[model samples]
Target: MSETLLQLRNVGKRFGDHVVLKDINLDIAKGEVVCVIGPSGSGKSTLLRCINFIAPPEEGEVIFEGRTWKRFHSAFNFIANRKYEAKLPTLRAEIGMVFQHFNVFPHMTAIENVVLGLTKVRGNTRNVAREIAERSLRQVGLGDKLDQYPEKLSGGQKQRVAIARALALNPKVMLFDEVTSALDPELVTGILDEMRRLASDGMTMVVVTHEMNFAFQVATRIVFMDAGRIVTIGTPEEIRNTTEPRARAFLSSILG
Candidate 1:
């Protein structure tokens, strides 16, 4: 088995008085693709954000590589009041995230967008970043559109560019939060196809999506979440065939 690349222990989060997550624990092995499926308000996106430190958990340990760090704590207790901090830049570099809305800079061309992070964060020279950006764009099947601006690209193309930007970081794991949810139905497949290609190439990924067919087809494990906790974790076959009440109800609702 591959080494565990990421671990979450006793993770919990709340916004004001609303609890969003509770004692969540999960381990993601290197090269494994785990898909998270749940209804809206189930904390799926919040969980992904916590992994990348976009939304720090109120209480938990987020372990990446060999180092572990607390992501958050109560502000009331002096000991726990200290803001959770770690090697954020390094950690963020190791885990690339693609948001639901393509956050690409509108002023930059596809290739330029991909090169921005490499140059700014990794401090690679412009020439080197451009070369790497081109290669990454090609990997996402966007070689011909490298010079296209965001306004000129389709939704799928823009998302692919975003993916290329993330890939340019050479991350070990990728977190995708409903990446296809905003695309038109006709454009969704192009982005998904790129994701399928990435998965086939052994890029560890954690995706939160509502597309059951895609989850069954691409993920090694499917995790179902509800009411701020994991309800089931299993292979696609187990998820489809299980008699668990939550699983059945969720499947019935989505598949209906």
Candidate 2:
């Protein structure tokens, strides 16, 4: 059995008085692909952000690689607590994220974008980082587009480059926050195909997606969320055949 890579316990978050996540608990195993699905405003993306510390949780423990940590505001309230601050860089490095909008730098070439973090954050030398960057791009089938800037690429290509950037970090886990949502309908399939390939190759992933077909085909487990809470979780087949009323209703609305 795969080891557990991440564990969330009693995780809660709020924006002002509005609760975005309520006492959420989840475990992500190594090399497992868990896809999250829900209606809009269900807090799926916010949950992903919390995991990666883009939006720190107001309450709860997030355990990554056996280290339990909490994100808390400091007394000054302008920054995260000092104890947690030291761990942020290492934690962020191990978790790669691809956002809804392709956040690739427009000024950098595809390879440059991939190499930047490796050289700067990971402290790899330029030559070493460039080699890894090129290999990552090739892995995503963007080998020929290394010199192209984000503006010059198609939406699908840009997303692929974004994936390559994340892969270059060699993260233990990858987070996808509706990565294909910003693309054209025709462009969505290419990105989804790449993700399917990643899952097949045993990359651990947590995806917040509206693409049910992709979820059904690629996810080892599916989590259904509603109103900022998890309604149910099951294997894809179980989700498809769920008897729970809310699950059935949700599946009906989406599958129609």
TM-score of 2: 0.95
TM-score, prediction 1: 0.93
In the range 38-63, model 1's lDDT, one tens digit per residue, is 88999999999889788888788799
How many backbone clashes are present in model 1?
0
Q: How much lDDT does each candidate structure score?
A: 0.90, 0.92
lDDT of 2: 0.92
lDDT of 2 by residue, 134-156 (tens): 99999988999999989999888
Error of 2 at 253 (Å): 0.7
Instruction: Write down the worst ten-residue block by lDDT for model 1.
Output: 78-87
Quote the positional error of residue 84 for candidate 2 in Å: 2.9
Models 1 onward score TM values of 0.93, 0.95
Clashing pairs in 2: none
Candidate 1 ranges beyond 4 A from true positions: 72-86
